[model samples]
Target: MSDPAPDGLMPFQAMEILKRAKAMEATGRTVCHLELGEPGSPPAPKVIEAVTKALPQAQGYTNAKGLAELREGLSAYYSAQHGVSVDPDLILASMGSSAGFILAFHAAFRPGARIAITRPGYPAYVNTLLGLGFGVAEIPLTAANGWRLTGAEIAATHAASPFEGLLFASPANPTGATVDREGLRDIVDTCARLGVRLISDEIYHGLDYRGPSVSALELTRDAVVINSFSKYYCMTGWRIGWMVMPEDLIRRTEILQQNLFISAPTLSQIAATVALGERDYSEEQKAGYAANRGLLHDGLSTLGFALGEPSDGAFYAYAGIAKFSNDSLEFCERMLEEAGVAITPGIDFDRVGGQGYVRLSYAGKRESIELALERMAKALR
Candidate 1:
């Protein structure tokens, strides 16, 4: 008999909104999609060209850790983008950040080990940990603190009750809070002192607006750094991402990758290799997101949606909807049905405080953001 499914796995609610929006679109109604965090652009031209050219020979299984060339390319990328030198040997390409997370969590912590993650952060982190049978400790971050986690917070929480590891995201999902270099350094130091392993999610690294996103590799080599080509490379459907592991965890992660995912999609990896070289194309995409962010932020604020913290990076705006409704799900549904604009309820990210909040993704084009704003404004009125 199959084992019972883990109770900790939660459905991705934003996908539900997308489904409803698709249903509306099927009925010939135009829906302004601000719900899912998907980029509006396709893979860079050069990336597609490379993949198309390589497709004939790209079908074979690769090294479980991924292709050597891709890993070297990613290593070069880290050096160029973050000024951090990473050894290509330590990099493992995975299906996406989702698979990378599974590998990292499995390699880092044994089942039942306690790991601390921020509340109002990425739901996948909590859900993945719980599904792996790891104990999750929520570290509450508030708007007063810009929704960013500080080293002091980690140290204080560890002092009261120790955990085996900490997982954090800069340019975090749902809430677009990015931690500065100094903050990251302090947190790294705190983790070292407290004997907690650090897993840094840098998937949104290239999508930053305020400033460059900090790499945990810049602070320490001991931390596991996960990144993806999904967001910045505009290749979500390509299903390719990677991780930079410490020397110690390399073999463990390699073994896990071998068993779980043989390697990321071969053609996607080829595309990603070319994508890594397209700095100009990536920057152009980032520019689009920046413009959309500004338009959405101002428009939502004018519509009386209270933003908790300024979204420093990423394409999401976590806004307070308490004035409209305490139930974020209901609020988002009303916005979708009445205004023809789909958004995500914040409850997907934070179970406790999220009922009063909703997350809107501005990862689409300028016209879409503008249209979504207009629709939402009308609905709110």
Candidate 2:
């Protein structure tokens, strides 16, 4: 038999190409970066100012869960935004949503359990579950369905042998696809019947162009909601994210957080609390991203790209380029060397259809995105 897949499958694909491109650029080559979904805009000035002013007092940790003030602020935000009352006792701060993944996986899934996740989904979901020895139940989504997993699809795949939980992202990464009201409702209903937990990643919730994204907490009280200030608020490097677990999990998670992360950085928590009060700044950034989203969509179509689905939210467009290359990694390497553009290969997201597709990040400024689009247009032609 062939060699088994390795356990520690680090995110080395993009990094490998990046290092190669860096070496080339040092020799006087120009490179356009479209590989990473990093916001070109900096955090709102109000948020930055808050962080600056609070740095002095935020030095010491108050509690492993989070500062009482910060947690209260987050609880109020949930009530205001979702109209769903969240008690301060229910929230826990963490290093990032990525940290939430680790803690949630370990505490909830139990060892060797299975997790239901969509194919061509965030690759980390698969790797993280696998690293924990949890088998993955892939729910392959199609473009016709907006690349979203449905209740019927789940029943088809695992109604008999259901997983312990279901993990999904709204305005999903890489594809930028959003689930409709019906799809979300159906899946939630099915999971209830099968006793599968639901973990919803709402990192891109407020970054949508079509409208504000949906939250899982609205559908069920038992779901785990993960969110961050990195996207809509332009606070990537801050590394602050929150988790809203069921009341029972909250207690377990609080003790878990104490031993695991101690607490999210005290300074970041202070700044995040302040940022929630600065909605004016965040809304301004959202408008800019909305414009960039439209511009990139039109530009990609003009460049002859077949978008997988309408990007209802987030800043990526997963497109097929079968006419160009069957091996996306090779295509990406060639583009980096010839066009001097840094784009992530879809193989990082999907092992099946990935070879015929690639993901483009439009999180940069208008000017840079225009230039990259022009280069892709020329290179693909």
Best by TM-score: 1
Q: Which residue pairs in model 1 clash with each other?
A: none
Give me the displacement of residue 366 in model 2, in angstroms. 0.8
Question: In lDDT terms, which candidate is top?
Answer: 1
The TM-scores of all predictions, comma-separated, are 0.96, 0.94
Task: Give the Cα lDDT of each candidate.
Answer: 0.88, 0.80
- Per-residue alpha-carbon lDDT of candidate 2 for residues 1-381, written as tens digits (9 for 90 to 100): 012267645564656667777888799877887877778888767777887887777678658777788889988887888778888888888887888887777767678989988887887888788877888888888877778778888887786676888888988988888876677888889888878888988888877777666788778888888888887777788898888888868887888888888889888887788788888877877677778778887887777667744588888888887678888888888888777888878887887778877887877777877888778778877
The window of 10 residues in a row where model 1 has the poorest summed lDDT is: 1-10
Runs in model 2 lying further than 4 Å from the true structure: 1-5, 8-12, 19-28
Name the TM-score of candidate 1: 0.96
